[model samples]
Target chain A: MDADVKQHQMKLIYDRYVRYLFIASACLMTIIILAIIIFVGQQGLRTFTEVSVSEFFFTTKWDPMEGQYGAASFIVGSLYVTLLAILLGAPLGLAGAVFMAKIAPSWLREIMRPATDLYVAIPSVVYGFVGLTIVVPFIRTQFNVSSGFGLLAAGFILAIMILPTIISISEDALRSVPRPLEEASLALGATRWQTIWKVLLPAALPGILTSIILAMARAIGETMAVQMVIGNTPQLAKSLFMPTSTLPSEIVVEMGNTPYGSAWGDSLFLMALVLLLISLGMILIIRRIAQRRLA
Target chain B: MSTGSRLISPKIQDKIATGIMWLAGMVIMGILVTFLFYMLYKGVPVLSWEFITGEPSDIRAGGGVGPQLFNSFYILTLSLLFSIPLAVGAGIYLAEYAGNNRLTDMIRLSTESLATVPSIVLGLFGMIIFVNMLGMGFSIIGGALTLMLLNLPVLVRVTEESIRTVPVHYREASLALGATKWQTIYRVVLPNALPGIMTGLTLTAGRALGETAILIFTAGTTVSRQLPDFDVTAAGETLAVHMWYVMAIGLVPDRIDIANGIGALLIITILIFNLMFTIPGKLLQRKMGSSRH
Candidate 1:
């Protein structure tokens, strides 16, 4: 009887030990986040000692060979591409979501839902390949541009890339609206178009905004596909037709050529730090919006 | 409220709005279909049995992606081998043990942030920590470690969600039957969540296979001409990287065709993996539903 009791006690201890192990694994994410922040922070900040933070932020030139490491141009380039992508993607995705949720036949939704999922699964590299072969050439020929690789190409590809995220999230937001709300809008003599524009969209604004922010974050951080089509110009873009480089693409193009721990490499880390900060802020906003929706 | 206030009648406005929505949907569907068909049309002629089995040649006209294909699977296996246990464990803890607390909140926030971190930044982190700090160099292990980190947040989230979807009553019954908590989870909960977990794993595998920016830095872009060496320290490049190299720097005339072939191969592989899990997932859901009824 005593031996049986002892064996049971050992089993309980073993169970508790395994539970702790699981808890520790769960905490690994926190540890990794902290480690990445600190490591990237340290490397990024080291560059500011050599070049003043203001200069890095304000200067437009990014000639690494000449020792000019200002990231203003890349920052602006990222903003320009992202903004254009949002302009192109948001209306299409929102309208598509509206159609899927409110107007589409059941069969159409079935087809679209899987197609959107597949779009999300399609690799960015493949998108890059398609852009290089088709979109860039088409843009060059149609628009009479000297080079097809520019902000327009990157923005156009990013717009398509972000459509899945926008459509699905906005669709969920639209679907979550109580049917009574739509019924009431229609009962008030509002036409279907008016009700959708003035009522459904306003009600779903927060969720739609969340989706937009997430898509913007994706557009800003997109590296390889943009790199392939963006023409890799280091200067501030004069127009959508002109070539430019964003922060991530700049890092990808130069990180290998630049010696590790050099001013240029550290500058790339600083850009990454900038990217991280922007994304973290966006995540926090998303979380807040989500919590608000729950409440 | 005036008659001339609106140029179009409400009926016409409704029609126009509906028309625009339909156009948007058609455009979305049209883009995806065109991309798939165009890629297949361009790539199919180049894809042959010899292309799949032959070694890649630097100067020759008919080099294949044989070694690169092997390395892609190799790195994916290594990463998944390391990631699954930790992710599953973390998932279990979050689903079953974590109460609504600050620690749980922090974990969720960290996972969210990690998910949003760009692949290139993670590659830089991997370059710093795994390759340089750990002295692993640019090798399969380093790349795998990076990929594991990249996929862990998604895996954990999916696993936690799947476990949570297993009815609470199931756990309660197991406990009432005098089963240990770990045994209850291992035997009852995990089995029920297996389909969902499998779906998540397949998606993660697809992501790992198509990843490029991360591997470019951690797994240096050198393809071993021979059959893949299992050594973790050896540099490796996957199909995505191979496509990137061929398109960007490969001066060969047939580079575009080669890239097209790789892209088609990648799309087909991903499509297969997705379908494999999704079909099983649908069947599992139906079975669970009927059993409950």
Candidate 2:
């Protein structure tokens, strides 16, 4: 009895120590996040020391070799492609979500579910390769454009990339809209279309919006696929078919050439910071939507 | 005419709406099929024993990606090695120890923020710390360390989710039988959660295998001369990165063929990874699931 008591005491001490270990591992995530923000901000802010903040966000010229560091074009280009991608992706993704959640037979749903997951698994670099080989040429010849690499090509590729994100989350949202509400609508003599649009869509609006915002975040930060097709020119897009550059793509294109401490390299870091901030802001918006739904 | 159309029936509208839904599904699937076929068609013709193991040429025609192919698995292995334990520990904490407290809230926020930080931004972070500050230069070690950041949030989220699926009764019974909290988790909870966790791991590995941007800067886009180089400090270009490099800046005459081959190889590997999870995941679920209850 005395030895057993001693062994139990030892076990209790070990358990307490293990709990601390788990807590430390969890805290490490916070420390790493803080490190990223601080380090990226420190390197990125060095660009403003040479080029004023206003010039970086307002001017179009990006000739870093000649000391011109204006980044208005890249910022604007990112905004345009993101919006275009959302416009094309959201409707189609939402339609698919509704079909999977409400309309599709169970067997078809099972098949398409993995199909969508596999779509997400397709590497972005492969998407870029496809854009370069097929989409760029097809756009050029079909549209009678001088070049096919521009906002349109990048936006089209991104729309496809973000489809799975929107579809999966929105499907979950639609599926969770209590069956009683659907039955009530049907009992009132509403058609299936009216029940979905008027009853289900409004009830699940917050969740659907969250998915859209997340998809928008993904589209904005997409670097490899956009870099491959966006033509990497610093000009503001004259038309959908004209060559342009986004913040992420511009950074990828130039980071290899510039030395790490040079203003050119720092400017790329700043672009990355801008992308980081935008995505973080979207996350906050998503949390707000979730809180509203809970309340 | 509009009033007459409305008078025609709600039945017609529902049918039309249903038709539109079917069309949307068809369009999405159509795009997926076309893209897959296009990649495989352009790539499969370029694969061979020579291309798989031959040395890459600088400006010559018939270069292969032997070094890059090796480094991809090498770095991926190192990253999974680094991330899995830390993430699992953190995940167990969230699922088992964390209560509704300020510390737990902060941890959750940090994980979400880490996930949202774009991969390119993560690349720069890795390059800043590992390559420039730490003096590793562009190397396999730097790349693997950065890739761990990409993997951590994903692994933690999955592990937490899988652990949550284990019934609370098992934990209560273990504790009632004099097992400590850690023992209950180690011997009972983890075993029950293994199937889902394994599936999550398989998916994470697939994503890491094809990851390019993070490796591009940290690994420095240049492969070492030695095949199967064990040196962690050597340059580690991956197949995905190789495809991008060939398209963007490679001077080799057979650049197109090389890119196609790498693309096809990556796709084939994705298919295999898919099989690895779905089959074993189902069998394990059937075997262990009933026992867990």
Candidate 3:
């Protein structure tokens, strides 16, 4: 009886410790996020020793060779591409979501859903390569621009890259709307389109909005694809077709050339910090929306 | 009829809307299909046994991608190895242990935020923490450690989701039988969740296999001279990074061909990897008789 009791005691103690182990594992996630922000922030903040915050955030003069470090162009360029991608991609994603949720036969949904999943699996580098070979040239020739590697090209690539996120999320949102609501609308002499737009859409708007903001966050932070197609020019673009660099693009383009602690390197780290903060802010925004939804 | 519907009846509008949605689906599918075909068309001719198995050359015309291919799998395996336990542990806490409270929500949000951190930023973090601070120095271990960050959020999410899908009755039955909570989770819940977790892991692995930015700085865009070099300290350039290097800065005369071949190989491997899990996953589900389908 004592031996059996000992085995049971060990099991009980082991179980308790394992629960603490799980809790610690979760805590580690919070630690990683804080560590990234601190380290990236620490390195990036050093750039201000040489360049003023106003000049860094508000002006476009970025000649690191001469110690000037204004970064307005990269910041603006990131916005232009991210917004343009949403403008291009979100409507199609919504339509695709609706089609999958309310229109497509189950067989079709089965096929397309996996195919869409494959979209996320494809590498950003491959998308960039395809954009370089096909979209950039097509843009250059079709628009008669000097070059096609610019906000337009980058936006086009990012739109495709973000489709899976938008579609999957919004589809779930739409699917979650009660079927009785749709049925009531249809039974009240409303067309299917009316039911989707007036009843289903209103119900799912919060989730759809969440998906859009999340997609925006993704579009803003996409690096290799944007870098390859945006031409990595530090100057602001004069036209959609003109070349300009976003934060991620410029960082990748110049990171290899700069040494570890030089002003140039710190400035690049600062740019990465900016990207990180923007994404963190996005998480807060998403959390707000989720809370409002629950309330 | 409403005022707006006077000119265009609801019936006609529904028809048009249906057509438009169908057109949207068609267009997206068309683009995806065209892109895949274009990649395969340009890449398949460059692929060969030699291309798959030979050493990469510095400036030569016909350098193979053998090293990069090996590094992709090796780094992927190592990253998954490092991340799966911690992520699964956290996931179990979220799904089975923690109350549905703000604390759990905050924990979940932190994991999701990790997902939102750009790969480029993560690359720099890895570079700072592993490459410089720890002095792992452009090694597979350094790259794998950084890439593990990318893997963690996805694994935790899938794990929580998979665990949640295991019916509540399964747990209740185990507890009713006087089984300890840990035993119930380990023996019943995890086994039922295994198929889902496996599928999710394969998907995450597919995504990781083609990751470039995280590996670029952390892994140091160069490879060991020896074939299949297993030194954890050796530079671990992967297939995706190799393709990017081939285009961006490579001076190799056959850089374009190399890029194409690598691109095609990446897509093929991802397809195989995803399918690998799916078939076995279904079989496992059937063997378990868990009623998932």
Candidate 4:
């Protein structure tokens, strides 16, 4: 009886320790996330109040050297590049996913899926290098320009970089399409392609959109590759061929030795904040959709 | 042929649609091929034993990525060491022990959400916490710890799924044979789950090897090309970071080649790591399928 009591006590201690560890670790993840938001928010807000609101918000000129900084141009650049990336990347990625999930032979699917997966494993830095050497030269020659680096070039590179993400996510969505749905479409004498389009595609639309939005989030926050190829000019451009700057790239360029003013720091912080908000919004939406589907 | 016969559309329309599909497939394949070809063309010339082993001399002129290479290996080794055991253990608890607890569900939700968090935010978080609050400064150790945080959720999710897939019968039989719970988990459950764990490790290692933004915030952008003094924490640049430094900051022609060499090396390393996961899983799956047949 005494031994049984001792064993029960020992089990209680073990249970308590494990439970506490789990709780502590889980709480730590939330704490880390909160701390980041607060720091970025605080620093980002400093720029808004310190700088003239008009100068920071309305003006297109971003001469950090002359200190007449406005993020209008950089913001435009990021948006333009991201839009271009989505335009080019989404179709290719979705098609590839569909082809793999629906049409490819077993051996082809086996080879292609891993091949696509390998692209994800390839570091962004390598992608940057490829863009610098191959894409840059191709753009220069094709456009007959001195500088091959521009918003369009950067967008193309980003599209390639993000392709794996879109492909994988959309593939999952496509796979979730009920087999019965496809079979029913086929029994109605629809062609394979038609069945895919009329039946599977509609069913998979939300998941595909979710993946595309996630890819967009990636493009918006992307720094190293976009920075490497975007020519680092903070000017609004009418054409896709023109040089550009992005918020993340600007933050990376300026944050190291930012002038000791809250305005500049806050502006950078605000950009981070915008990015944070975008990602948070995306996650919330994805979570809702996921919960609904899973539930 | 049956597909063609069933498609009783105007022959021209069917032909056109089929043609467009074929064209689209060709274009995508072309892209994949061209990307590979261009990378090899630009990146291969610089790949050499001397280049791989040499150190960065003048930031602008020329040197090998010896330091960055060491940093990559070091960070990969250390972060995996710290993260895998904890992640796998947590996964085991969730998959086997939790059994529908609300807390476990919360953990699952959080980890999935965590996977979607943009890496840059993770970088910013690491900077404030590790670099400033913890006073680790820009060092190898700092980067490794930061990486551990980024990788943990992914490891947990992958490990959990893989562990859950292990047959329940194995666990029940082990218990029925009078094995202790711990022994059952270790002997019966883990062995069956080894392939999946390795698969998860491969993916995690690939991400670790290729990770950049978080490292940039925590690990300073200094590339020391000499032989790595593993004893010192504050000394090296990772291969990915080295590529960025060479292009954006270093401003040297020779450094560009070295960077290219390192870029190629990094891609090859990751590709190999990816294969490690894929090939084994495939072999195992095939074996299982054929046995069932």
Candidate 5:
């Protein structure tokens, strides 16, 4: 009888111990989260205050050798290329997602979905090599240019690279819309196309936009592929057909040589901080959207 | 009404849309197919056993990336060894123990953002923290550590998802049998999640194998001549980095011919790994579905 009472007490103690372990584990996660954000902040902020913030944001020239390193050219180049990629990519990606979601037969979706997932796992370097061999040569021959690399080629490569992200996310978004809404629209004498444009699209707009921004963030940070195809020219190019520099290309090319007394290193850090902010903003927006949807 | 109806029938529009969709699919697939074609075209002709086995040499005579290939495997294995267990432990803790609360959400958000953080930024962190702060020279260990960090978030997410998929009834059954929580999770939950864990680890290994930029800042470029005697903690070049250096610096002009060959090999290896992860899960799903029916 005494042994049985001891066993019951032991069980109570073990239960409390398990709860303690759970709380400790939760604390560990919180600590790691703080560590990552704090580290990024420390590294990023250390460099930003070292240089003129306006010069980093506004100027067009980026001659690291001459010590005139404004990220303006890189920023413009990044935005322009990303914008071009979205213009080319989002519509096609949306169409593809919609087709797979609403139009494709079940067998086709089964085949294509796996194929798309496989596409996402292919590394950026292989994509770079692909862009180098196929896109570069095609551009050179068609445009009769001296350099095979061009912004258009980079944008096109990025568009392809981002397609899977857009497609998968948009497909999920579209899939989540209630079927009753579509049924109701159809019953109200609306055509399928009308139902799609007026009903389904409006419902999925936020998610589709989220996917777009996510893709844009991806395009901005993509390094190796864009570096290979963008010609790594530091100067801003007027035409999409011409080669230009983006923030990622600049960081990759210039980080190797710290170039003492030059703020190029600091500039690189600032660019990274900007990229981080953009990604953080994206996540916050996504969390809000997800919360509202869940609610 | 007759003219308007004839101009654009619902059937006609649907047909056109379907046709356009098919055309778009074909075009995009064409790009992917063309890429594979070009890689094969440029790569296959030059691919010989000697080319694969030889050591990389001077600018004039292109040499083999034998050393780089070995380094890649070593770095990949080491990175996976370091990351998989830590991430799995952390993941199990998250999925099984931690409640769905603000703290857990914060951890998850940080991890997701970490996933989006550019490889270059991670590379920078590695340079500062691993190379400079830790006093580790640009060596294989530093690169491996950096790669481990880079792959951690993905592994954690995958592992957590896999663990969560283990049926609740299994846990309840184990508890009912008088097992402790730890014992139940260890015996029932982990065994069930093992295949999925392997899938995640395989994908992570594939990424580590292909990584270059992070290694560029962390791993120094001195390629050791001997294979078996090679110390991984020391600086060495891997296959992907070798290819990048070959093209960018043109340090070995003759070896540039083999770049595509090396790339093709890497891509094929990664594709195989991806299939290993995805195909099994898919086949298992199909089997389950058929059995249910």
Candidate 6:
């Protein structure tokens, strides 16, 4: 009896220690996040000290070789591509979500659901390669452009890339709407189309909006695929057919070549900081909307 | 009433709406199918046993992706090795031990934010912190560490979810039988949650494999001409990076063919991983009767 009690006491101590250990492991994520923020912030802020913050952010010229380091054009390019993606993807994604949730037969759902998951699983680089070989060339030939890489090509790739996110999230949101609501609309003699637009979509509006915001976040941050198609010109895009660059793409193209402590490198870090803040804001907004829906 | 009748009937409107939705669904499916088959059709002509096993050549018309394929798996293993333990531990703490409190909320928020951070930004972070600060300079270790951060959020979320699905009675029974908390978790809870955890792991592995932006900066774009060495500090390019490099900068005569081959290979590998987890995931879900969203 005495030996058994002593073993049990030892197990209790071990459990307590392991529990704290797990907590420490959990805390590690917070530590890493803080470290990233601090390190990036420190590096990024150096750009401002070297050049005025307003000039760095507002200047359109980005020739780092001659010391022109404004990122206004990249920021605009990111927004333009992301906006185009949202315009092209959001409606189709919503319609597809509605079809899957309310209209599709079971057989079709099974096939399409797995396909969607696989779509998400495919690497972004593969998308880039496809865009580079197929879409860019096609655009060049079809439009008779000098170079095929442009905002339109990047936007098209992003549209397809974000389809899975938009579809899944919006489908989940639509599915979560109670069955009784739809039944009541039917009982009131509302048409299926009216029920969806007037009843179901409004109820799931928050979720749909959340998905849109999330998809927008993804499109803005997408680097490799966009870099492959967007001609990497650090200038304001003249038109849909013109080449442009984004913050992330610019960093990818220049980070390796730039000296570590140079103002150009610091500028890349600043771009990263900006990207980080935008995504964090989106995530927090998503959480807030989700929580409000739950409440 | 006849004169006031609308041009389009409500029934027609409903049909049109339904038709549009169906067409939208078809568009999505069509895009996916076209992407898959087009890639395969273009890539399969060049794919061969020799291509899979032979070393990449810069001068020759035909070079294999052997070094890149090996590097991909090598870095994947290294990252998983570094990430799984901490993610599992943190997951268990969140699911079992964390109560409704500010600290838990903060942790949850941090994980979500980590999940949303752009891969390119993470690439920049890795380049600065891992490559420069840690003095690991464009090596496998640096790449793996960056990927570990990227995959941890998903792994922890999956672990917590699976742990939650392990019926509370198992924990209570283990405790009632004189098992300590850790003992119950190890002997009782973890055993039952193994399938779910495995599913999470498979998914995380897939994410890590597909990652390019993070690996691009952390893992150098250059691949060893010879067979891959076991050294962690050696610079290596993954298959995805290889695909990018071949397309972006490769001046070889057969760059297009090689890029196509790499694309096809990547798609096939990803499809295999997806199927591997999904079929078993369905079976496990059915067996456990645990309906996960």
Instruction: Show model 3 residue runs off by greater than 4 Å.
Output: B1-4, B100-102, B282-293
Score each candidate by Cα lDDT. 0.89, 0.92, 0.92, 0.76, 0.76, 0.89
lDDT per residue for candidate 3 within B106-217, as digits (tens), equals 7887898999999999999999999999999989999999999999999999999999988899999999998899999999999889998998998899889989889999
CAPRI grade, predicted model 5: acceptable
Candidate 5 wrongly placed segments (more than 4 Å): A1-50, A187-192, A259-262, B1-7, B285-293
In candidate 2, position A186 carries an lDDT of 98
Better candidate number, 2 or 4, judged by lDDT = 2
Give the per-residue lDDT of model 1 (tens digit) for A220-242. Answer: 98888899999998899998889
Candidate 1 is graded, for docking, as medium
For model 3 the interface RMSD, in Å, equals 0.8
Model 6: CA > 4 A from native: B1-7, B290-293
* Model 2 regions more than 4 Å off: B1-8, B290-293
Candidate 5's residue-wise lDDT over B1-293, tens digit each? 24655789866766677777666666656666676667667777777887777877866565887777878888888888877766776788788886778867777777777777777777777777778778887878888888877788888888899999888988999999987787787789987887778777776777778887778888866577686435756786788887777676656656547678788778777778877776786677557546645
Candidate 3 chain A has its poorest 10 consecutive residues by lDDT at A108-117
Q: What is the interface RMSD of candidate 2, in Å?
A: 1.1
In model 2, the Cα lDDT at residue B207 comes to 85
lDDT of 3 at B141: 95
DockQ of each candidate relative to the true complex: 0.69, 0.77, 0.82, 0.39, 0.39, 0.75
Q: Tell how far residue B159 is off in model 2, in angstroms.
A: 0.9
Show where candidate 1 strays beyond 4 Å.
A1-7, A187-191, B1-5
Residue-level lDDT for A87 in candidate 3: 96
In angstroms, give how far residue B270 of model 1 lies from its true place: 0.9
Which residue pairs of candidate 2 clash? none
Q: lDDT score, residue B86, model 3?
A: 98
- TM-score, cand. 2 vs. native: 0.98
First chain TM-score, candidate 3: 0.99
